[model samples]
Structures are given as C-alpha cells and as structure tokens.
Target: MRYTLLGVFCVFLIFNASQTLAVDTFCQETKTLIVFGNGIMNSEPEADRSKNRLQELLQATLTPDEFKRLEFAIAYNQSYGLLRDLYESLKQKLGADNVVTSFWRWLGGRDILPDAVQQEFLRVAASFDFSTRVGTQDLSIHLALYRSKTLEGKKIVVVSHSQGNFFVNAAYVALHSGTDPLTTNSFGVVSVANPASFVAGSGPYTTLFEDGVIAAIRAATVPGIQPPLIWNLTNILSGARTSDWKGHGFLDEYTAAGSRSVNKILPDVIATMNGLQQPPQTVQDGIITATLTWGAQPDVDLHAYEPNSTHVYYAHLQGISGRLDLDDVTSFGPEHYFVSCSKLETGTYRIGVNYYSGSGPETAQIQILAGSSVRNYTVPLPSARGSSGDQSPIPVASITVTGDTTNGYKFDIVGGL
Candidate 1:
C-alpha cells in the first residue's frame, strides 16, 4: 500500500509541473512583434552600415528573448536611394524570412520638400499606382504581407519615425474606419518624434484620423480587438521642435541636432512594450498614494518650469517652483502625495501636487471627509532659503487629481500644521 501511494504522488507532481510549464510557454508565444523602419532606415550610403546600426540599437534595448520575437520591415524612399540595397541589408540582419522591404522608386526619386511643398508630388505619385503611396497603398500591401501564412497568429508592432507616421496613419484610417473592419491588420503603432497635430476639430477624417491612428496607437487599442499599447518619445535635448513639419523630414538632422540621445530613446521604447505585458493593478479604494523621499534637502519648492505652459509640463520640468496646493495648505513637504475615498471602489485615479517650503520642519495636514480624522505627515524639503529680502517665496506648482468615485468626499489641506 505504501509503494502504490508513492507512485501516485509522483505522477501528480509531474502533471502539475507540466501544466505550469505550458502556461509559461503560452505567454512567451503570444509575444509576437514586428518593427517598421522609417525613411531614414536606408538613407546611409552603405546598406550594411544602416542595417547594422539599427540591429545593434535594437539588440541593446531588447532582451535576447524579445529580440528573437521581433521582425523588421524597411520602408525606403524611392528617388535617390536604392531600395534593393536597403532590403538586402535588412534581410541579412533580420533574416530574409522575417524582413519585408517596400520601395516606391518614382516617389523616392523626387526632390525632398516640405509637406506642403510636396503636395503636388504626393498627388501625382499617389495617382500613378494605388500601391505606390506609402501612406495608403504601401500600408495595405504590408498588411497583406502581415496576414500571409508565414506570419499567422503573430502580434504586430509598427515603429515609424518622421514621415512614416503619416503613411501608417493613412493605413490605419483605411483599415479601421469602413463598414468591414480589417481584423487582419490589427497591430500597435509607435510614433517616434511625430509632429502631426492631434487636436480635435481639425479636418473631415479628423475623428477617424485621431481615433484609428494617433489615439488608438497611444492607448494600444483598436475597435473589436485588444488595444496594442502605443509609446511616443520626444527628445528635449535634440533641439528639434516637436511641432516642426520640416524638422521631421530628415531623421539625420534631428539626430545630429541633439534633440535626444539615441541611447535614452531606444531603452524607453522597449520598456514601454514590456510594461504592457505585466498584469494590471486593481484599485480597491478610490484613493491612490505615491511617496517621494527627500535626500539632499528637507524642503523643496515646486513650481511650473514655465509660466503659461500646459498641464503636461507639470511632470516635465524638474526642480522648478510650481505650487500644487491641496485645499488650504499653502506649503507642504516634498515627500508624499495621497488621495483617499470614503469607501473602497473599482476605478482609476491620478494625484498631482506641488511641494513648497516656507518655514519650520516642513509639515502639512491632509483631510478627506469620507473617512474620519485628518492625516498628518512631515515631508522633507532640501534646505531653508537664505535670509534675504530680495529672494521671492517659492512659486505654486500645480497638482491635478482625477479618479472615479465610490462615494463623494471633499479634500482640503492645512499647510505648516
């Protein structure tokens, strides 16, 4: 009887181990990704140089496992460049089976011009052959290629720089807006330094344009399909204006100008994708909390880096005096920001605040009426301001709070409590 029991136990353990392995394999298998290169992908005189640079950059940013799952597609500008050379280079790096290179010789041959200047060229070129236009035709061809038997059951990721964003946007509109949803063309889009204005009320296809292309890409979602999370990286150091249409045309110019380092940008791209794969967090309370520890200073003043800047700047500028006041607390410590609700609920919430220093140990009190009692805490600031009459008190840094409600509650702060 003892011998028989041992055998059964061994069998059960083996079965359970196999089940765990199977789950892991399924997750790894589902991570299929494709990378698309923009016009500059092949601009280098030597195909090998361009291909190797891109491959090395990708290798550094992605894990070996992630690198294995990625495929590359190079879109070559037709006129002065040789599409065949670019294709050959990409094929060598990504393997012929995994790379798809598309070239429009007539369009690529035309003189490089600004978007407005190239309008006539685009009309002439797009009219010639449906497959010639990179935005519409080329994208359709690529989608078809993606759906081919070789790529079945694979997830899609489009990485486009500069003008490539335009082409991909056009393709997204074409595939998504119509009556018949192009389920086969499902994929996430990553726009690097794209300058296109995403403002609403811009044009006719604006709704479709924003929804299918920019917004969907950002959220990583498509209608009737799981949204592929999208990432956009803008470089502040590159000196390239994020809004300039001309600046986007030449990738080399932007890179040379130092808008952002390639090292910094590439890592972020890979990290964003990895983050999406992690299981999402569930918020039990309407409240969400974040804490920042002060190292060098006990008190720090938070302010908008620039006056009249949009809300987005609140996160961008570091070490600026922008005051984020919670209720009446005029000055608070630098370490903690919190949001609380009367009851627990399921929803999303955001907390924004600016920390400033006036005097004493830099303490603040926060009260949420939903729950009983006020929460008191000391936030460390860097150091006290020098005793000078000329120096101004720290400016107001803004903090924004957004969340769904399980119950309604009012929030206020008592500064220097």
Candidate 2:
C-alpha cells in the first residue's frame, strides 16, 4: 500500500507541473511587439543597448496591465553573417513555450564581402538561396511559427528599422499570397528609417524602386494576418542619402534630415501605436511659387552695379515646396525677376536676398507671388562704409501654408539689382 501511494503521489506532482506549464504557455489576448534593428542587429553591443533603451521607453509609455500583456521581440545580428546567433537569441528570449519571434536575414551569405562589393553582389545575389533564405525563406519560416498552436491568436506588431523593413515588406507580401502559414493573423508594422526610400526618396532603395515593395506590403489580406499599418519615421537631421546599413549601426553618429528631434520621434511612435495619431500627409498638390523685388537704391550708374557686384541674392523654400526646379529659375533671367501670383499647395516655404556695395547705400522693392496672390516685401542694400558691408545673406521667411490646393497659376515678374 505504501509503494502504491508513493507512486500515486509522483503522478500527482507530474500532472500539476504539466498543468502549470500549460498555463504559462498560453496567452489568449496577448499583444506581441517585435522591435528590429537593421545592420545593428548584427552587432551585439549596439543591439543590446538599443533593446534596453527601447524597453525602458516602452515601459514608460505602456500601462502596467498593457505592459504585462505585451511581449517584446528584438531581432539583431541576423542580417549579417550572424543568422544562427540571431535565431538562437530570439528563441531564448521569447522562450520555447508561448512566443514566436521571427528572425530574418536579408543580407546573409554576402556578409563576407566588403560594403562596395556587397552592393554589386546583392543585385545578382537576389536570385540565390542566401538571399532567398534571409529575405523570403526566413519570413516563410516565421509565418509557420506564428500559425503553430503555440502562437496562434496573438496580435503582432513588427517594428523594423532600415533594411529589416525591407524584409518585413517582403514577408508581408509572401504572407498575403498565402505562401506562409503565420500570415493568417493581424499584425501592425512600424518602420523607422526604413531603407525602402518611398518615405523620403534617395537611399539604397530609391523612392521609385520601393513603391513596388510598398504595394506588396499593402496587398496582405490573410484572415489571421491583419492588414499592416505602416509608420515611417525619417531622420530629419540626415538627408535622404543615409545608408540603412550605416544608420542602424551608428544612429548617434548620423542625424535625421530636416532636424527632427529624437525625443519627439519616440513619442510620435508611441502615439501612432496607441491609435492616437496618423502619419503626416502632404497638404498640397505639387506646386510652388515665390516673388522677387529690390527697394530703391542710390542711383549709381553701371559703375554702381560694379560696386554691388560682389553681392549675391537667392531664395529658398523649405519642406514640400513642390517640384519647382532651382535650375529652371536660375536659367531664366536678367539675374533678377518677378513671379506673379501663382497657385501654391499648402506646405512650408521661405525666401531671401543678399546685398553688396562698393561704397553707397542702396535699397530695392521686392514682391513675392504664389497662386494668384502677392506678398510685398523689402530689403535695404547696405552701404559699403560699415562692417555691415559684409552682412551674410538674409533669409526672408514666411508662415507655412496649411490647406491651399488651387492649381496652375502663372508667376509674373518684376525688378533686378
């Protein structure tokens, strides 16, 4: 009787342990957020640091209950030559029980080549297994994992930076086509400095080149795979030429174009995730117009023109100032010209002029025209007499237009220095 009782007790213990495991293994209403780095994912130190910082930021943004229900996944070191390491690390962090963290490598077998060589290699390699494995194959694997019993029914958020975004887009396409199992669930994607280029133009992936990728991401329609909501965050300090490989590995070293603040970017990301905001949209159809003028200057003959010869003037428009070309404007005139009221779409704009003098004070009247309206402005030419003679170029500025969309107005002209 004693031996039988002991055996029964052992069985009871085993049953209880299995039950506990089962409980921990299932999360019915959990949300999964996958944060990915581009090239940095391959660098251990950078990846770990970025992950820690992002986690802290997320903690601050999410409520206690929401945070608890959220599962975080970071993919690093997988795109380079470190595919296996990236896979193992994600598995360990997510656990063999309840989570599915997809690990993909877009730049796998070609890691041995230098940057210059890889560029050429990727063009041809796009057809090879190495490219297929990381780019499309790995994504397929991830889909299968997501469809497995362990991860079914969970909400997924894919946060990828740089090249990783490319992989995400490809995965999205594959899933939409019913080529992958995990594509059956709804997923949200947040892409930062996504190398896809359509976000800002000019990158490893040109804007035109990435349009197809965007279309692919948009095509996803699996029952389980939620239509992806893509959020693109561009670096305002760095111009559009930044490399995905470089930016992901050295974020601190590079700044975003247009001087966008980093602190603001994170908050914007959180707000977007919480459904509190939408990405900024282009306010105006493509159109830009500006006016030029010179106030009265002390009459000096053609000789006077010589004194002011060193002085130069130009206009600059910030933000979406339309497709107006600088060369078009520069090629047109008697050096100075006037633009009549022409329709301009809503966006940011600015204008300015410079002055120089051989010795006398001169002034000129300036008028700016955009979309059937003229804003009169003035700038005084300084006398060559004082230190003010060397004043740098003055930037005339204006308020950003918000909702104007009338089109095809002519820019009429006036004046020269």
Candidate 3:
C-alpha cells in the first residue's frame, strides 16, 4: 500500500511538471498568431476538423520556409454562435438551398428593390441574436489571448475574415481598450473582406453594415505603434473567384478551395506575415499585383486599365481580369490592384494613379509583381486638392504579358509591391 501511494505521487508530480514545461515552451515565442475562422466554421467537431484542415492547407501550400513560420492557434470556433443561429433560422424559413443565395445576393447589394422575398431574410440575419454573437465572439477571442498567461506581454496578431472582422475588432477593444497603446503595443489585426459595415449598416447588402460597424472599423484605422492594418482584399474578378461562390467565402483563408482559399488569399497573408520580420516572399497566384505606398499622401488611389479597355479605378472597381482590392483614403496609402492574368486578352495593361487627397506630387513608391518578376517604380504623383469625385488620375506605367508560360501567364510589369 505504501509503495503504491508513493508511485501515484511520483506520477502526479511528473504530469504537473510536464504541463508547466509545455506552457514555458509556448511562451518562448516572441509573438502569437491567432486565426479566427468563418461563420458556420467554428463549432465543436467541425471546428476541430476545420482547424486541422486550415493548418494542413497552410502547411501544404505555403513555402517550406513559410510553413515553418506558421505557428498559430485557434482563437475561436463559431459553430454554435449567433451566425450559426441565423443560418439555421434562415434554413428553416427559406429552405437550405435559398439561404446562402439570398443572403449573398442581399449581401452584395443586389436585387433588393424588386424582390421583397429577401427583406425578411435580411431582417432575420440582422436580428438581436447576431449582435449577441458578436459580443460573445469578442469575449471568446479575448479569452484565447488571456488564457496564455505565460505569454502575458507577447504581441498578439489576429487574422480574421468576413464576420470574424467584427469579432476581432471587439476583441481588440476588449483587450487593449483601457491600456496604453504605446506601452503594451498590445496587438495587431489583419481583416479580409470585412464588409466594413457588418454591425453598423442596414437596408441593403452594400449598405448592410450601418453606423456601429463603420465606427468600429474607422477607429481601427488609427495608426498604432504595433500597426493596426486592416487588409480588405475585395473582388477576385476572375470567372467566379474562389470567394464569389459564397461572396464572403475565401475571406478566413488557408483553405484550399473555400472562399478565402489559400491560392486566392495566400499572397496577402504572406505579405502580412512577413511584415514584421524578414522580407516577404510573394505567393505565386498567377496574378499581377501593384501595392502603392506614399507616406505623405493619406489618400491616393490606384487604377489599372486592362488590355480590353476596361478600367478598374475606385469608380469602376470591377473589371474583366482584375479589381481594385482596396482604396485607402483615411490612413497611410497602400492602395492595391490585383489582376488574374488568366482573364487578360494579351496586351499592355496600363497602370495609372490619382493623387486623391492630402496634397501630392507626393513621391509614391509603387511595387509591381507578376510571378517571379518584381520591379519598383518611384514616381511623383501629382497633387489634387478637392472632393473625392475629381480624382484627376495620371497614367503611370504598364505591364505587357507577351505570352503564356506554364504558370498561367508569362508576364512582365513596369513596377513591384
């Protein structure tokens, strides 16, 4: 009896020691990478499967070096949340087939005035319960960060998409609200296709997120020492982008084929992940990307006119092959345009710029990329002092895709991002 008791005590000590060692190991990392999944994606068994799948997707697709750096944890599972509730409610009311369709159509701000059928669906989606879910998601993400008590002072970065953006912002507010931004440098958030108005808007899909959501995201734009960059990669313009299927799809990321699929969204993820440390390695998505940065200009716009004579500026956002991924006016400029060359008609694609606001002749550093070819253009973007409408754009450079290579299109651009 004495021997058995002593053995049990020894085992208990070993278990506790192992657990402590595990936590210490986790804390060794300088920062934490947390991924917030999509709606209907964060439930028990599904969440576990999705988490594993997400990790596997990243591991499989990301370069071996990138995969090595991909140390992430699941912050929240939304399987049983308010969005799920809305889904279930919609399913019952309009049947499963129409739920996603109606929601998406309404979401993209289409066909609302003529069809009264979707109004009820919108009402249901924007109900009180969804608001409660956002609150719950906020706390849930906060808990994920706080639970790692061993890593108390480590910087936290949240990778969120779609509705997850709202949750992540709420979590940021919860975590860093009363604290000193300069001191803790608490955390940074990366949001994709945030809808920007999810929690705030009403009426239609385009105006879906009203006041509250807008205020929250606008607040997020305020530059912090830790960098509060909101990565809003909108349309993919190719024949049904990976996300266009669900509209909000390809929006969480790291997945192989879902809306925020790794292939479609991985490039941006690569840029953001390597943003803090070593230089980023671009993802090979067969698309030409131009990212503009002018420290002096707060609101400069990027425009890409295709060989097909279609323009993709802020006004005509969607084109034959590419889309204006983001139009940043409120903060430092990183206005971008991504072109899936598969849809290109084979000619010189004209790249232009508009010095939208805050005075220019601003030295704009433009980075253009296609496959392995990257070039940097330093141009003096002329100044414009007026309303948002008069964007007097100037044609800056061009990318000529002579022909096709094995990897979609063999192309060379005038500039790098």
Candidate 4:
C-alpha cells in the first residue's frame, strides 16, 4: 500500500513539471517595425511590394499581428542613384530595355563595354557624392517617417542591413546635437553584416561601419537621446541559412543577371526586424574569414565575385550581401573580408585581386580562417603589360560550397587562377 502511494506521488510530480515547462509563444508588441534594406530593397518600385516580400520571408516565424506591424514602406535615401544614371546610360547604349534586371553587380558593364568605357564608367561612379550621399536624401525620408503622426506613440525599431545601416548611423549623428520631435519615441536598431568597416576607408567607394554596430549602440546612448534598445548582430555571413525559417539565407534571388523572381531575405534576419532576440549576438569561430594584404603604395583591391556574378570589391562594397572588410591604398597592409558559410549561398565564390595603382609587380597574401584551421596563400600579380590603371584580371582564391549548410556543407577551395 505504501509503495502504491509513492508511485502515484511520483507520477503527479512528473505531470506538474511537464505542464510548467511549456514553450513560450511569440507575442505581439505595440510597436511599429521598419526595415531599411541594402541597395536593392529601397529600389523596389513600390512600398507595398517590399513590405509584402518581407512578410513572406517572416511568415513562417511571425504571428499575424506581428506581421501587420511591419512597415518596409518607410521612405529613406536610396544609394546608387548613380546606378539610375548608369542604367539610363546603358539603356541608351545597348538600346535594350533589359540592360540588367538587377543592379546588385551593376555588372560594372565588364562584359559589354570596351576597356575605356568601363574605365569611364568607374570614374563617374567613384566621383559621385560619397561623403554625405547617405545622410542627405535616404536618411531624410527615414527621419520624416519617424516624426510623422502615423508612427507616433508606437515604438520604432529599425533593422538595417549592409548599406542600410549607414543611413542609420547618419540619423544618429543628426540627432546627436539638437532635439527632434520624436526624441522620446521608443526607438530600437539592429545592424546585420555591417559593411561599414570595409567601406569606411579613404579608398574610392569604400564605406565605414566605424568598427561594427558599436557605432549604433553609442549613437543611441548619446545624452538627451537614447533609444529603448540597440543590439548589433555582427558578421552573420556564415555561408548557411541564418535561421530555421523556410527560404532563409542571404538573398533568395542571388542569381545576379536578369529579372529576379523574389526578394526574400534570411528569416533569422526577419525575426530581428522588430527586436534583437533571434540573431546570435556575436560571430562564432567556425565562420570563414579572409584577409588580403598588399604593399600600401599600390591600390590593390580584393574582389570576391559571387557565383551569381555580383562582385565584392572597392567599387561595390556590398555584393550579394558579402563584405569586403578592408581595402588598403596608402601602404603594404593587411585588409580583411569575412562572411559566414551560413550567409554564403551555395556556389563558387571567385576571389581575385586587381592592380589598381602602383606600376610595380606585387605579391598578394590570402589568409583563410575556418574552424580550427588557418591557411595562407601568396599570389603574385603579373607585371602590368602597359599603363593599365585599374583593370588587372588576376585570380587569387576561390571557395565553393555544393550542399545545404544545415544538413552538412561540402566546401572546396582553390587558391590560384
């Protein structure tokens, strides 16, 4: 009889524990979530379209009310306005309406144009208003939306990726000195795969992230101006999908040429569109990190061209969401670029180096950091045949992945052209 009573008590205890350990469901917060996409998102012809695409990316993870609060419609400055001019230029030259369905690579018009035309195109692009280009129009629209009555009283959270984060930084600086009507508004920010570190350099078309999302955090904490929350999910390019959400990864339409069928972003990123919980706080060790170093005198640029044809280089800092972390023009120095195998779409990533300036022959170093292994390669650039200014076609390193990163990733590397 005593044994029967003890068994009943044990069963009761197990049931109680199980009931208390139930999963916590996501709840909707009374705030508005806004997304500031990299170059391409803002360029979408319409706001409703971008908003819907974001919802689809997050549909698997977000509740209906949570989805309703999202607003990709907020107006912000659009970078690559130069691309508009270039598109028109190319449209006129090619006399083809389909100059390129997407502008991710701008193709640098490499395949179509003569060497001199490409040079001219580069010159025009590099000369555009880089100094304050981000702060002017895109940021202005973003601030206006914040101050608008529509978003009043609602918490405002910004999820900025790549170049989008640059606009966020400018907004902080604008609010640093004076007072804005929306000063007390609940504001939060999250920056993913910040290209600011690579772009910040004095090199042409380079941007500065001011060393990661700390810039956003510090900006939020300024006296008289503090957002309710600020979290930076740095370097999430692990070459795999960023979350468990279906259809999540870097870019769904990563194929670089022609019209892309979708604009779905990684679902892990979509979750953080409102808050900081979903993305891991720091970069893990297993991700791939590449460092490129060359003598300071030559304007040697590291170009990592995605299998999709989007090239990551000085001219284009954010290519298919990968980063060119460092670019050196003044000295023989170490420049680094990194992306998680998770963020790397399954394809061949062709890494190459260009002799931008300095006439002499130079040896380039490639350092790959993965798991517990570190491999380094020394590549020599062929002597400049003539007075070639910036277009030296030398391949340095290549990394390819053939399978799903989650199930098990198969990555192969080739070090030379």
- lDDT string, candidate 3, 65-171, tens digits: 44543445555534345555656766776677876666545433343422333433344323323334567433532443332211223334455544555566566
TM-scores of the candidates are 0.32, 0.34, 0.38, 0.35
Q: How far in Å is the alpha carbon of 374 misplaced in model 1?
A: 67
* Best-matching candidate per lDDT: 3
Per-model C-alpha RMSD? 24.2, 28.0, 25.2, 26.6
Looking at model 3, report the run of 10 residues with the lowest lDDT sum.
Answer: 200-209
Candidate 4 lDDT tens digits, 27-69: 1222454654453223454333444545555565577656554
Candidate 1 per-residue lDDT, tens place, 1-417, comes to 011221121112123332332110000122344445454323534323333445566776666766765544444333323345445544554556544422232223333333432333323222222123445434544433333212234545555553455565665566455433345434555554442433111211101111222342334322454332232344444454333222232233223233453544455446444443322111111132222222222334322221233221223332122222212222222223223222222222222223333444442222221122222233333345533311243322222222223112222322331
Compared with the true structure, what per-residue lDDT tens digits does model 2 show for residues 1-417?
011221111112133332322111111123444344444234455555555555666677677666654545454424544444434444554553422322233232222323433333233212222223456544533443222211223444555554565566665565456422333335445555443423211112211122222333334333454333343333534445433342233244122222232344455446434542222211211122332323233221110011112222223222221322221122111122211112233333444444433445554333343332344444565653323422444454442443311211232223331
Candidate 3 residue spans exceeding 4 A from truth: 1-31, 40-54, 61-66, 77-123, 128-141, 144-155, 179-186, 197-245, 251-264, 277-417
Whole-model lDDT, candidate 2?
Answer: 0.36
Task: Show where candidate 1 strays beyond 4 Å.
Answer: 1-31, 40-52, 77-135, 149-151, 177-186, 199-264, 275-417
Q: For residue 181, what is the lDDT in candidate 2? A: 32
Whole-model lDDT values for every prediction: 0.34, 0.36, 0.47, 0.45
Better of 3 and 4 by lDDT: 3
